[model samples]
Target: EAGVVQSPRYKIIEKKQPVAFWCNPISGHNTLYWYRQNLGQGPELLIRYENEEAVDDSQLPKDRFSAERLKGVDSTLKIQPAELGDSAVYLCASSKRTGGQEKLFFGSGTQLSVL
Candidate 1:
């Protein structure tokens, strides 16, 4: 099968602009995740979805960021009124199931630039 797919591989916006990213995970994968990575840092889990339900989102900035996995398949992540500090790479990953040792497949990621 195919790996995860992300659209608009790159985005550039001014501060306070709204931006969105899309992801399509591999078929049969029951768990999906959204992560953000700043320069020189590892990807940080922003949200995790098991099927269509969001299972973990503690690291997500609810005030300006939101995500949704519809029908346990495709997902979208949005950031409204993005700040200059929000410039980073947004990554989408998925796995067959959720577990401590399960391997994850990651998309190339959407690189965001806020000026």
Candidate 2:
């Protein structure tokens, strides 16, 4: 089973520029999540997808961020007009179920460096 896969392990962009990251979840896993980790803070959930349904996205910053899970296997997260403050690791994770108690397996993440 492939662990989780993410692309462009790092990205650099000027403030107000757009950036995107991609993720592919583990095989057979039906629950996927996108998280944001600041400099030293723990990962915070931005969105969660169960199959193709976005079960939760209350934490996502609507001002400049958007996400989607197409076909329920792969996902993309986009930041339009990225901000300097958006520089952080955009992590993708997956679990066996939608239950929050389930353990999550994370990808290395796309570390966005906004200038």
| Candidate 1 global CA lDDT score | 0.96
Candidate models: Cα lDDT each: 0.96, 0.93
The digit string of per-residue lDDT tens for model 2 on 1-115 reads: 6899999899999998889999999998999999999999999999999999999999998888899997999999999999888999999999989775898999999999999
TM-score for each model: 0.98, 0.97
Tens digits of per-residue lDDT, candidate 1, 8-111, equal 89999999999999999999999999999999999999999999999999999999999998788999999998999999999999999997899999999999
Q: What does the lDDT read for residue 20 in candidate 2? A: 93
TM match of model 2 to true structure: 0.97
Clash number for model 1? 0
Best by lDDT: 1
Which regions of candidate 2 fall more than 4 Å away from where they truly are? none
Estimate the Cα RMSD of every predicted model relative to the unseen true structure.
0.6, 0.8
